[model samples]
Target: MIEQTLLKCEEMIQRGSSSFYKAFAGLPSPRREAVHVIYAFCRMIDDSVDEPEESPYSIFELRSHFQNLDHAEGHFIWPALRWLFENFPQSSKDQFMLQMQGQVRDLSFTHYETMDQLESYCYLVAGTVGEMLLPVLRDDSNEEAQSAGIALGMGMQIVNIIRDVGEDLTRGRRYLPLEVMEKHGYTQQELERNVVNDRFIAVLQELKGAALDWFKEGLDNVHTYPPESGMAVELAAAFYAGILDDVAASGYDVFRRRAYVSDEAKLLMFRRTAARYPSPFGGKGAAAVH
Candidate 1:
């Protein structure tokens, strides 16, 4: 029954995000299942806002049930959460709540004003994910690793913003800070027009610089994580950072062409990760994991 229950989450992860599912799938059973559950629940939370038709519960209901998890029922997630906490009690309950809290912000905060505001939003939505995964990825945690985890999460969220600028606009949202645009001499009107010129590129470049800094900070102590987990983290970061290069290759026309890393590129990333760390499962190192 438990195996059947968690398989639902495995399916969810497979369907939701290839980079995530592929990166964590290699963890030995307990850790792999734990990552799947965490991602599936997070994906469900995001879907509740962006694709509510598909999610089982609304954000408010999710928050309510999550607050009362032991008695929570009516979904695969509750049982999955039970298994997760039962096995890995070190996972942060507060971080999970903050994740839901961030989604709640998506309801009213459709647009961003400044880099500061955007960073706060990123922390709510993505940084918390770092905190949530830290315990599961590593047995012992400290301030340094915790901070790096948050930095990585927030950095990845910034990449999402850079990649989804066009899609978000279609949905009446803009995450790029107005200050960023103004500083680069780009304007809201230009963004809405899908301009991909020097100033426009400059704006995203600014964000990219910051994102890279966060990625560096996040991975500063890569040696600290268990070897396989470290490799997985690097692979995840590579897949994400690779998208920026794809976006640039397309001349930064994020408005129409959605950037993606190809299978060949993903294989190369896996090889690079494997060379840096030893692992038992051994990466597929072939056929696009992303």
Candidate 2:
């Protein structure tokens, strides 16, 4: 029964983490399974918050699942995540933080009043995933590795916020920090208009700069990975960083259209990434460790 539960959980995670899973193909089987389990947990949390209909029910379901996982002994995903928590002495799993996000989602509290607030929100929903992943992938936990993972996670999340600005606004959600918008003299009305205004464009430019900085920070930390463990991280980071380039090419008109990298561009990125680091794991990939 536990095996069946884990398999079902794996299926759910694989579907939710299609973006992450593609990169995991480069991982060895054992490491790949850990990544899958991590993503499954993230998927469960995201579904609780993002599902448009029956989201209330989804939150309850996730809470129930976690309760069962904590008290019982047979669930596959539970034990896998539990093993990761137990094995990584330097790590901490803030289940309370995870539960808090479900509450935030339930309230549809997506808008932000300041960068600090946005940062806090990012840490909960995305950075926590990074913390979970680092312990699973790295042989030894390093503060540098954890910091880089958090930055990468935050950068990816900001990219998602930028991409979804329009849709989110339509859904009565706004993720752009109010401080950034007001600082630039932009308005929620302007966002709702979804026009290519100079003020709006400038706001996006500032946000993009911030995202790029985080990406560079994440890139710097990637070297801490012992080559093999770093492959998936490199792939996902490069993939998400490509979205920033997409936004740039669109002239920062994120309000008018959501920028997306083409499949060709992804293939080109994959090819370039593969050429630069032949082995997904360690070995020569470490030579680039500058």
Model 2 TM-score relative to the real fold: 0.82
Residue 249 C-alpha lDDT in model 2: 86
> Total clashes, candidate 1?
0
Among these predicted structures, which one has the highest lDDT? 1
Q: What is the TM-score of each candidate against the true structure?
A: 0.96, 0.82
lDDT of 1 by residue, 1-290 (tens): 99988999999988888878777755666888888899989998998998888788999999999999999999999999989999998876899889998989988888898999999999999999988888888999999999999999998999999999999999889999999898989989998889899999999999998889999999998799977678778888888899889988999999989898886887788877777664343544323254
For model 1, the stretches where C-alpha displacement exceeds 4 angstroms are 279-290
Candidate with best TM-score = 1
Candidate lDDT scores, in order, read 0.87, 0.69
Cα lDDT, model 2, residue 24: 56
For candidate 1, report its TM-score.
Answer: 0.96
lDDT of 2 by residue, 145-244 (tens): 7889888888888888887788777768888899999998998887888866788878887877788788888879676675566666777877787777
